[model samples]
Target chain A: MVTISCRDLDVDLGGRRVLSAIDLDFAAGALVGVIGPNGAGKSTLARAMLNLVPTAGGSVAIDGAELVGLAPSHVARRVAYLPQGQEIHWPLSVERLVGLGRLPHLAPFSRIGPVDQAAIESAMAQTGTLPLRERIATELSGGERARVMLARALATEAPALIVDEPLASLDPGHQIEVMALLAARARAGGLVLVILHDLAAAARYCDRLVLLHHGRVVGDGAAGDVLSDAALDAVYGISAWRGEAEGAPLFVPLRRRD
Target chain B: MSLLLPLLLMFALLSGLLSIAVGPAHIGLPAMVAAIEGKGDPIVRAILLDLRLPRAILGLVVGAMLGAGGAALQGYLRNPLAEPAILGISSTAALGAVIAIYFKLADTYSWLVPLFAVIGAVLALIPLLALSARGESALTLILAGVALSTLAGAGISLALNLAPNPFAAMEITSWLLGSLEDRSFKDVLIAAPCVAIGLALLLGQGRALDALSLGEDGARSLGTDLRRTRLQMLAGIAIGVGGAVAVSGAIGFVGLIVPHLVRPLTDRSPSAVLLPSAVAGALLLTTADIAVRLVPTAMPLKLGVLTALVGVPFFVRHLLRERRLW
Candidate 1:
């Protein structure tokens, strides 16, 4: 089992303190959703965990191994990160695009051998991107591209996965599928942390939710505990419609609170 | 990609041989081989060894440098339009050579021309790199390159205007047009080392370039060092193109067009196309040099002229398609 712990972690972007003295712990085999309104430092916390952003204070450790000063490849090997947006620069085939995830594992001059090949195939299968392997990723539809990108991250076969804002701009069906995939990954004994906006989806699928507001974690616990009306009003200035559908609890933002 | 690589190699080898065998006086294959095995007539050996052989080898090496340099730049900047010439590197290197020629600096050290050219290429790269470091658009970086090219052009013109005599001015003009004509083994030795260093640096970036296809953030997350990659790539361009310009006088377009020609066969993966593009560049340049020798004209058509003649149409088509990038 793997664990990521952040102790009083602080992050600085430009000259501003974007993340301040944040403490959190993530254990394996759980689906944790990080939810916040825009500019609430949800992304910053994720970045700080991976050491992608500059950390000004405190420490991050993966299974008690200090994450700071770790090489990016080393970090990538232990944790797969799928950054926000569907921005692909080249018109590479989906197979090659996904194969790129094996980069941190392979020697610099070495070709992708049978082991890497199996991983590539497995990731594609997991994401249902096997049939789209030959298609150019840039030309793929939004849902398909999202899946392919997730496949690229999965190809790393990392035990810990962090994806940022994955549901944005995807259709509702695709959004549901994406969330289900994250939950399934967690169920299969992996740590899956996702930054998402859909509170209902998070409530339905996520085992836990961490709420952020203005560079600080306001609440962390089960959806019922963290998505309380008072927390919602203070953090997002909105009220959530807490109810149930298909025997699953749903939390929908009802209205903006002044 | 596997099938395409050998095919490109075959074409490059054939063109290299053609470059050696099909010069102004056709030294047939048998004669060329005999001369190499130390059995041909002495004059034939001199023509083959002292002249055509070096020229042919230089063509292959310089052409490969241009091609590889283009591929590396295109891959890093993620733009099909990037090449040493368009990025102002070639022009700055040419300015270095012109300065060496104008000041008669080569009369003593003889290697000073190429060394200065390498320096010039590096000098031009500094500003371009600085602009890119500020997170400017590719268009802005390219425009900065254009400005550098214009400045180098003005510098070359100053050298031309202050030429000691008409003969010296004519030599500068011909050299600026670029050719492998009359270049000896010494030229090859001087250029090959620098080119070799540069090519090694560029070709080494294969994995990093592949990772970079996912954009800067994506590549970084995949363990690619974007900063180190950019610096190494820029250094490779400067040193490689510097050596090439010192010898061949800034041959253009081979770097730009060869990648376009070869990309389709490599699944368009930027890294996968690097080697094929280099080989294809060697083939195209060697053939073009041979054509200049065979094509009847009052004066031999400049290799740069031929390359631009061929390369401009491709550039125009690419611009039209990628105009949205600007």
Candidate 2:
């Protein structure tokens, strides 16, 4: 188990501040959904945690170890990231693509061992991508490709998983399926932070919701507490109709705020 | 894919052997075998051991370098069209060789031309890397390469214009056409170390290149050091292609064509394409060299000329087939 903590994190991109003075802590065994309107720096926050983007100030650490000071391979062993764009440049088979997740674990010249193979198989099985292992990744449907990419991330078996916009191209069924998989991963003692645009799904599946507007966290806590009507209107510029369905929380954007 | 690698290696070996056998002074297989055993006629032995063998070896080495360099560049840039020549390294090296020839340096020092050419190749990478360091896209990189190539082409033309005599000018022109003819073991020795170092660097990057196929951010997330990878790739291409151009002049398209032809056979994995592409490149150049010898032209056709003739058409066809990508 790992705890990812960020203190006053700031990021600047091309002279524009994308994220500013952000502080958060992600404990293991929770599915945290980062939700915001477009251009709220959701992707930037995720990238900043991984040190993929240059941080202007402040510190992000995993279990009190500075993330920026660690070697990329070391950080990768602790945190696995699934970028927003699902880019597979080559026509590599699904199995080979997922096997890339084993990179940080394997030595430079060593082949994939039995333990690595088991992790890869388990990841594929969990993501329902085992059946498409031999198929070319580039040829897959958007939903299937997203699952394959998710499997690639899961194959890392890192303590912290940061996924951005995972439900963008997925259908309704696949979206819930992916959300359930992420929730299950958290239940199984992994820290899963996913960025979701769908508020309903975000509330339904995530144990905690981080609502951001223009790079600052406006709401963060349990799903019900964070998705309050006033908070939704203030941050999202919309009113949401909240109700309970089958003992699970449900939220639908009702109208744009005047 | 496993079978393809061995087959390509076998074909490259056969082509190299054929190149050694089919020169103007035909040392038949029996005589060649005797020469190998150190028991052939002195004349046949001298011709086979001194002339044809070095030329064949040079062709094989230069071809392999370009091919592997091409694959490595393509994989790093994540663009199928990326090659040694695309980034202006070859032309810059050619310019260096031409300047050496124009200054009569080639006459005074046999090694001066290749030495300058290697310097030129390494120098050309400076701007290419500087542009990429600013986080330029692939299109920007290609555009920068075009500008650099044009600048180097102008430099070559200036060197040609400043030649001491028409005969010197003519010599520079033909040399620019690129050939493996009359190369000695000395030439082989000169280029081998740099090419070997470059190939080792490129080959070691297989796993990193595989990670990069997921795009830059994805690769970074997977623990790839993009900056380090970029540096290694730039240095590898510069050293490898520089060494090749130093010896063989400007051989075009071998780098571009070989990788594409062999990619499918390698399951389209950029890392997996490297070795096979190198083998296929050696085979292509060796065959082209043999054809140059056998075609019975009044003047021997240049290897670069033949490759362009074949490669340009195939490239056009590829563009047409993948037109939607643009």
Tens digit of lDDT per residue, candidate 1, span B173-275?
8888889888888889978998999899999998888887777777878888777787788788888888888899878888988887787678788889888
Error of 1 at A83 (Å): 1.0
Question: For model 2, what is the alpha-carbon lDDT of residue B243?
Answer: 93
Compose the digit string of candidate 2's lDDT tens values, residues B1-326.
Answer: 77998898899999998888887775677888898999979899888879988888988889999999999889988888888888888888898888888888989888898888999999988898998897725666778779988999999888788777899999899989999988888888878887898898888898889999888888888889888887788788888889999999999899998888887667677888998988888899999989989888898899899999988998788768755433
lDDT against the true structure, each candidate: 0.86, 0.89
Q: Considering summed lDDT, which 10 consecutive residues are worst modelled in model 1 chain A?
A: A46-55
TM-score of chain A of 1: 0.96
- Best candidate, DockQ: 2
TM-scores for the candidates = 0.93, 0.96
Candidate 1: TM-score?
Answer: 0.93
